[model samples]
Target: MIVDRQGRRFRNLRISLTSACNYACTYCVPDGKRLVAAQDELSADAMIQAVAYLIEAAGIERLRITGGEPLVSPKLEALLRGVSQLGLDDISLTSNGQLLTRKLPLLLETGIRRLNISLDTLDPEAFRRIARGGDLFSVLEGLDQARAAGLKIKLNMVPLRGQNLDQVLPLLDYCLERGFELRFIELMRMGHLARAGQNFQQQFVGLPELLALIGERYEYAQADAPVDATALRYKIAGRGYFGVIANESVPFCRSCSRLRLSSTGWLHGCLSSSNRHYVGDLLDKPRHQALPALQGLLVKALGDKQELAFAGGTTIMKIIGG
Candidate 1:
């Protein structure tokens, strides 16, 4: 088992299968004229093999499949099948919910038990604006499909100050009425923001304020949302449940129990920075050597995990498969 300096055991793995996405959310992958070539991505088979090795070496019991849009990958079903073959304790996916209407049946058949759909706005126009070219109705249909397939679904919303904050109550009403879990995530800094001269520090909303507002109308239960280190979960008084991911305002690094593997084959010890180790290079080496190297790297990285530093910057959530 890999233990961090704070004694948190790493038992979860999040893997990004691809960086390509169908939707261009303004906050996520804003309209950029030039596209980064896709030559750097890891092949599906290599990803599966690496995950198998990691699970064996670290005893990771939970796995989350993520992407710019995981459903955008044609081989998503096959990948899920491979993950199931690993006998993981839990398997889930984070998607944009655009293609889910057509893929939900196939996904359920492949052993995916839980899903998280990123839907930042409840208004049709607002959704189109935030997601750039997304259809709000398509996502709603996808949610219905997922529910019918018996998959536990969670709505992931990124609350921006001037953007979708107004839709908070409406989004909660929709979730509570439909009995679906909803999560409100704070915007975070990532790639290109620094170069673009944008301030990440001012882009976040305080969790206390958001929670206080919800508390006025609902009761929340604290639970875990594994992908995020700063997630505080809750269950609506008489409605359903929801979560708040306050990455910028509140850092939960001490309790972090997961590691992220990028689609390009880099292992990130922490998600806020670009610091990572290349696990792909060790693929050609013997298992004994590769496993120990991975463990040592994780141990060292965890020992060096940065404390909460709130400087403004940006990284594409899609690139990191957040």
Candidate 2:
């Protein structure tokens, strides 16, 4: 096991393929900023090497490909194929769904079986306003295509207090009606909002209030969650299941077994922790030659992992994949 100083074993790895996204979401991508240029990013072969090292050295079997928008990556299919060849137990993706309709078939062919789509609002006007000119119809079409492709789908909604908070019921109803799992993510005090000079506290809505709102209409019970999962899953009476990722109100630092690899190749042991180590540099050599140094750097990062849970401060979520 790849155990940290706090004894949290690393089993999940989230990799950012690129920072270039089409939509400028208010919560995620504020001003259409790309941390690293497309040309300057790592190649598919390098990503394959990075994943191999993580799986062998860190014991991470579950992988999730994320990005400013992963579907938009020119080499996405190649990267997915490379990682899938490793025989991983689970290969999933977190995307904005702008290009998913066109890419779903290629994605499934490349071995992506699970998808977490970011759909904040059902109202087209709200979507355009929050997502900065994104088409609600395109994302909707993408969802339809994903369902038809037989992929497990999860809807991720970051409900800000004044923003999409009112659309919670509509969003949940849409997901429940379609038998798609839904997860409500609390507004994290980091990334685009911070960079935009927006206060997360002002937009924050804790899980209690969210659940209470759902409880008014249906009886709900807590359900089982994955060993290292941060979301608290629940089953509602007469309704489908849903979850809440209460990172701000109730941080899961104690059970966080996930590691983040930025598009630029930096290793982050904890999401909110600013301390990062460059693992990309080691990818230039053969896997056998790079293993020792990669293992050392991962251990160093584990030591730097946060002992206590705290709100995110410095890291950009888009750069590391939210």
Q: Which lDDT value does model 2 have at 314?
A: 66
TM-score of 1: 0.90
Backbone clash pairs for candidate 1 read: 189-314, 190-314, 190-315, 191-314, 191-315, 221-234, 221-235
Instruction: Write model 1 residue lDDT over 1-322, tens digit each, in one string.
Output: 7765557766888898888887777666656422232678877777888888889777788899998778888658768877789888998999888888888878888888799899988799888778876688999998987787788888888877777778887888888888788888877666655444445444556688788777777767675555535578776556667877776677776677777788888877666665677888876678888888878777755654555543433556677678
> Top model by lDDT, which number?
2
Distance from true location, Cα of 77 in model 1, Å: 2.3
Q: How close is candidate 2 to the true structure, as a TM-score?
A: 0.94
Write the residue-wise lDDT of candidate 2 on 1-322 in tens digits.
5576567877889999998777777776557543444566788888888998889998988999999788888879789889989978999999989888889889878878899999999988888878885688999999988888788999999887777888898898999988899999988767655444447667878999999888877788999988778899999877779999998777888888888888888888877777888977798888778888888888877776667775565677888888
Query: Whose TM-score is greatest here?
Result: 2
Model 1 segments beyond 4 Å from truth?
A: 30-37, 194-203, 219-229, 308-314
